[model samples]
Target: MTSEADLAWIASVVGDPARLRILLSLMDGRARTAKELAFLARIAAPTASGHLAKLLDSRLVAVEPQGRHRYFRIASPLVAQMVETMSAVAGDASPGDRRLRRIDPALAAARTCYDHLAGRLGVAIADALQARGHVAFGDGSGEVTASGRAFFAALGLDLAEAGHGRRVFCKPCLDWTERRHHIAGGLGAAFCGHCLSAGWIRRHRDSRAVEVSPEGRVALAELLGVDGQALTSGWPERAAA
Candidate 1:
């Protein structure tokens, strides 16, 4: 149970601009070192260490030690969801940033939200699933249908193997840029991984934006009925169209 003290602690932890920056950098499901986080947060390494310690103590971040290096990532899916939702709320309350608008088209076309696919491609996939009766959406949630199991199984993602985790199984995450819901949760991450491995999409070298392949267009059309080409063409195309 969360007490008021717990809420206050979390509020304080995430309230700092430097700490918030560090957390946002780790939101893409990548474990980063203190040095990298320091650079991203524009703080000294020593200051980053202090922020990291506080985040770690608050259980908002987790550390994994590999050899001589320790990497940090958001502690859990719940934390990721909280950060994402808060971002959406904040975006809603403010005038959109002019700088972000400059790159909005690219980000809207394809981008990553934590470990899952987001942006147009993500929303398209989610829409496809619901259209085909492979999934269902509720207020702010979603569930995989029996057909979803068969569909994903054919694609080589054994839903059963997604397994038990502190992460959610299947759910809709509101996309901040697109103003639509995209998949996020264990299933979302798995879907994104499968797409990457299959060469259907490739990440940009210096951006969170992803590019769709020619082959990916056909595959998405044939498999999920998603029009990847149209998405890349800078237009919003729904599966039904």
Candidate 2:
């Protein structure tokens, strides 16, 4: 059980602008060295190192030594979710707010929320799954139906293997940009992995935005009935719910 003191400690650890920048830089599920993180966070090497020590102490980030370099990454998926959720809360601008209109188009279209998908593309996939009775979301968790198992099996994804870990099997992650839920957890990781491996989606260099390939368009259209072109071209605006 996390006491109020524990919660406040964590909030303070993550509240620093430089530390939050470092955390966001690692949100793409990549481990980065201190030098690289300093560059990304736009802080001096010594300053970034100090911030990193605090993050390490808070257990919000982890370090792995590779060769002579120490790489830092968000400690776990739970940590990533917390950061994303906080972003959503902090980014709740009014509809007519200029900040809302200034969001990057590519990121708002499709991006990685840690290892899984987020943005319009992610939400579309979730909607398709629910509409087809492949998955169901209730409260904060989700479940795959029997047919959903078969559907994933057809795609060569082993749910048992994906779920065989300490991580949550499936859950809804609130997208900061979309202000809607996108699939997260083990199932979300597996699906995103399959897409990347199958050449359906390609991650941008040093960025979370992903581009759908020609093959991805066909695959998503046939499999999930998602219009990749519409997603890419910015059609299908967010309608009234």
Candidate 3:
């Protein structure tokens, strides 16, 4: 039930460059404080607050209060999907010649998709899951075969245990960098957890960039039946996270 007037107002709200940056910064689905978002968007706190207020009114963003801190995130998964899809398209369209630190050549290998794993590792795992016939669905409500469940269990990633009554399990998260799709949802988080615990990958010292090690290459091959090293060779090794 969206009124034309409301839509018009939202259009205005998202039209500003600063607000657009803020919205894009939150696409990874992580709740962020105004100051954090402001730093990411390179805007002032008051300005970020103003944009957040407008986004909140549009229902494009939601806020949570934690003691003295208030945090904001995209209003819903639908919003996250929309932002990711749009960012993917926009990033492709505007392949700037300038070399930015964030746009490293290795972005595809390991990076953050909001808060979870994304990039080449993300894309390949997503593709392999679908290719292996383990997942059969689009962005939500996927069905995983029993063998698929067992296969992951061998990797120390039991979906039942990893899922642990959280968000939807075995769902697809459309890739913003690859323009394809990646496994997301509870299952996705579980898989990510397994990778982390296995010493296969490590988050960059301070950045969202993820680096795969020699061990990760061996582990991903043994666990996922796909050679992580092979897939990332000459590919965008540094895909966004």
Indicate which candidate wins on lDDT.
Answer: 2
Candidate 1: residue 98 Cα off by (Å): 2.5
Among these predictions, the greatest TM-score belongs to 2
TM-score of each: 0.56, 0.57, 0.53
Candidate number with the higher TM-score (1 or 2): 2
lDDT of 3 by residue, 1-241 (tens): 4688877887788778998888877765567888999999998999898888889988888776666787777765455556555656667623221222145656655786765688767877766666677676632357678778777777677677756775677766655555445777777877777777878888888777788878888867666566556545523322421
lDDT of 1: 0.78
Task: Give the alpha carbon lDDT tens digit for every residue of 28-111 in model 1.
Answer: 667789999999999999999999999999988877665677778777545766776677778762222233345567777888
Q: What is the lDDT of residue 135 in candidate 2?
A: 91
Question: Which of the predicted structures, 2 or 3, would earn the higher TM-score when compared with the native?
Answer: 2
lDDT of each: 0.78, 0.81, 0.69
lDDT of 3: 0.69
Error of 1 at 229 (Å): 2.7
